[model samples]
Target: MSASSITSQDLSIGQIFQNFYRVPDYQREYVWSESDAKGERGEEVEQFLKDILSEFEQATKDGAPEYFIGTIVVCPGEDSVFDLIDGQQRSTTSFLTLCALRDLLVELGETVPSTLAGQIAAQDTNWQGETRERMRLDLQYEDASGVLVEYGEGRGKNARREGTRSIRNLANAYDTIREFLSVQFPSDANGLRRFHGYFTNKVKLIRIETPNVSRALKIFETINDRGVGLDAMDLLKNLLFMKAKQSDFGKLKDVWKGVTQAIYDAREKPLRFLRYYLLATYDVDAKLQEEDIYDWLTRNEAQTGHGIDPIGFAERLRQSALAYQNYSRGRNPAGGADHGIYNTRLLGGSAVKTHYILLLSGRHLAPDLFERLTRQIEETMFVWLIAGVASKDYERVIVQAARNLRRATDAATFAKFEQEFLVHQKSLNMQMFRNALLRLHTYDLRKFRLRYLLAKLTRHFDVLAYGEAGRESLSHYMEAKNDIEHILAQGADDDAKLEFGEGADSFELIQRLGNLMLIEASLNRVINNRPYSEKIATYPSSQFLLARCQAAPLTIGVNDRITRAIQKLDPASSWDRSAIDRRQQWIADAALEIWGVPSPNPKATSEFEMLIPSPNP
Candidate 1:
């Protein structure tokens, strides 16, 4: 490890970029196009420019103090160039702002200050007397760098118009700065020049230059620990690159890139993925904290036998990331071939995060065994989530299951593992699940969770109606723009109040699970605040089982104890508290069967039946 030197000094933007800073190939592309004011990035381009100009505007009366922007971490690289380890986005935006201002100056026929132009583009001459035009801040992406160089050279008319995210963002930043300055100065060359002077001289950054990349990465991590921008995943990537051999660095980079892109594609947090990965791969016997991943890796170096094999670890990480991505989108990792779709549908959603570690670790199982395990895990999650089981206990069970799954070499072993760890657990048993369902009311649940439950029930009823499963899963319906509709309108008009008696208790009955149906948003809007008779008449148009049930009676049996309870009621009949109670009982009975809640012992059933309260109670 190289010794690092850290110092903080306020340097103007021009001085910082003029020192020939280069964003290396491994660095992330410019992502500061959006405003930090929107809670996306730090110090947006417009705000940054406005702040600098504000200081400049106040300079006449009070001689403005140096405006501190933020810190930038750089390391001395080969050939007198500095690799930007941090603050690339800020530095890149600053350069673009300067270029836009310089172009505006050129358009006004003012002498573009040589120093300003130098900061934009540096001219280098070799012994052959050939001059090469190099951008002061060379970005990793060629198209973006080209935009900066072309615009900086006063060729704004010929800059690249369309390209990658970085290119488009750079161009947008330039246009924004140019337009803002043009409006603020309004063709006044003197005001523009005065503003430029303040910008290049006043706006400051604490530049921390390091001796090497290793030291630079450490300093970068230290500085950004307090900020939301960087986390353990970013630092881990840097550490992996630092620890890997020079020859293996390229492969490590590619794998890390894939892992990041996969997680991004999945819309998952990188730190969360890393924590899950650690939990899945290592049998920690407890929840792995996000901040402790790197430390755990350091302490468990012997697990890999040799020093941490970045390539091997990265390959596993990528595979796990792919599994997570597939599970997130309700698609199987094995391309949804064979019975993989069943597993995908069974283990997809926000509630499945509890099962992610187990699924990820067992991703390599055979198709049949994998699907079986997925079903068990899904059952466990469904029971635990709906039953309101303690999250800590849920996590512990899943973690233990994951560890056992990792050790199981065959289908029989995995089956035993599931029976021992999940199926046989008291907290996840069918009876508890049944008891929980009996207590649930759609009105008491979150809108999304309620929708999910109703959607699943819809699917279950659909399978009974068709004698086969439907094409859409619970996740598919939830992901679609489906709205939870109250069968009894929330707000009844005068005629509706007359039809269905006007009482506060009647309104309260409308919120229960039996009165709810998942329907299209547009249809829900159309039926909004309508009478039950009018709403029931529209049910024939809906494709969902719950809605279709209102068209006619459909007796679909799940078992001897549970059957499809939804039935068409007379549209002209008054929908009162009794009606709501009947529907709630029907839905609860179906739910008990749907969630696989077991019945009490035969000997105790008569006593239990007497003790069990009715749905209304």
Candidate 2:
């Protein structure tokens, strides 16, 4: 291999595009937009334009020095061409701005600079067909290419078509440039000329050229080391491609493209998925950091007698990506009733990523065993979260659990694995879990957390009391919009205060989980702060356990714990502090049953030791 040569030089807009620049097929599309989804001016694009226009205005009186726009890194290719490694967004947007200026010059009957007009489209026989006019800045994807070609020809439209986000964004950028120029110059040709000269000459970029793609990408990483400007996954992808033999590049690229498309909605999917993949596939320790994943994979591949080939590794990544995607979307790759239920109930929350890593690592297990393990993980996480376990503690426990679970070879091993690792480290067991629930002030939790608790209760109530026939799927309640209502209203008026008794500590009771119910948000406003009699009258209309508060005879059901408790509470009685206390105790008991914690086994020893020193010590 030839030694890689690196050179950096300041380049103006005109000088940068003088040579052919091609965005490789593996590159992401033109994702720059004029405005965000909210119709607000895009931060990056607006800043770029403002900076350039301000520089142009200043140059009219005092000649401005070169304004540093950003950096561009490219690899020298065959026949004086270059493959763009970074700075595509900046280059593409600049090209669009030039095209807009060229068109405006022609529209005003001013002599358009031939060099400026020539930058829009270049005639190249190197293009597959007979000599054809192509955009100077060629994009990888069809939608962006089409928009670029149309815009370069002065026929671009602002209306979005049924296409990818890139296409819409391309069109939006062109329109943005045109509108910006028109608004800044109005009908003055002199202002347009002045702006054009400054944009072409003053705006600058540090062009870094390397002899090979690998070297260029290294420079790309070095330049973006301080920020997430370059995704870690993108760097890993380039590394994998660089490692593969030239003969296998096409095959490896195809496999990688398929894997990326499968998880396109997941931003930085490779970084996350690959970490879990390595943790599960190898016998790594519990502290497997995400940043070390690439180096770990490389070291593992270099090991004697256990090396993974590039193509085989890529294929495994493809398969694992699909499984990871399924788990992320709460779909069961291994179809079963329990698997479905576990995924549906536990998959949509803040702690979902922890579960995803565990599930992804154990995806190869039998459906039944996988379901059992899923429940174990969910239960473990529930205890940890409710106990307010420190983040570091939770991560340590979960990572260790993932390592142990991934190493399990069969159902027996899996069962034993749970027994060993699922024990509470510090304050994270049934006793602590129960205490946490009893002391949990619902209002103290963020709205989403409170809603999650109520949603879980709603699901548990349906299964325990209603059975299959009267079962109302609280999946919607869990996943959708549901209001958390205070049974004893937060701002109870004088009438409601008198009904509940005057001396009652309404504030203390109002925040308690026992005093809360999940009702449709639409009904909360209507039933707000009513007397206990009126509130109980509205209960029968609800699908949740709140409806069981009606005077009708309680239905005979299997696990009627919560429903029976509600049945015992008299609607005619004042909903005072005493009522709140009774309901709070009932809720604490139900929570224990809902999120079951394993009892200590005589044969098992604690696998995890808490880092915190005991108070007695």
* TM-score of each predicted structure versus truth: 0.76, 0.81
Backbone clashes, each candidate: 0, 0
Query: What TM-score, to 2 decimals, does candidate 2 have?
Result: 0.81
Q: By how many angstroms RMSD does model 2 differ from the true structure?
A: 5.0
Tell how far residue 94 is off in model 2, in angstroms.
2.4
lDDT of 2 at 136: 76
Question: Candidate 2: lDDT over CA atoms?
Answer: 0.67
Q: In order, what lDDT does every prediction score?
A: 0.67, 0.67
Clashing pairs in 2: none
Error of 1 at 570 (Å): 16
Candidate 2 lDDT over residue span 328-364, tens digit each? 6555564333433343344335344655667777887
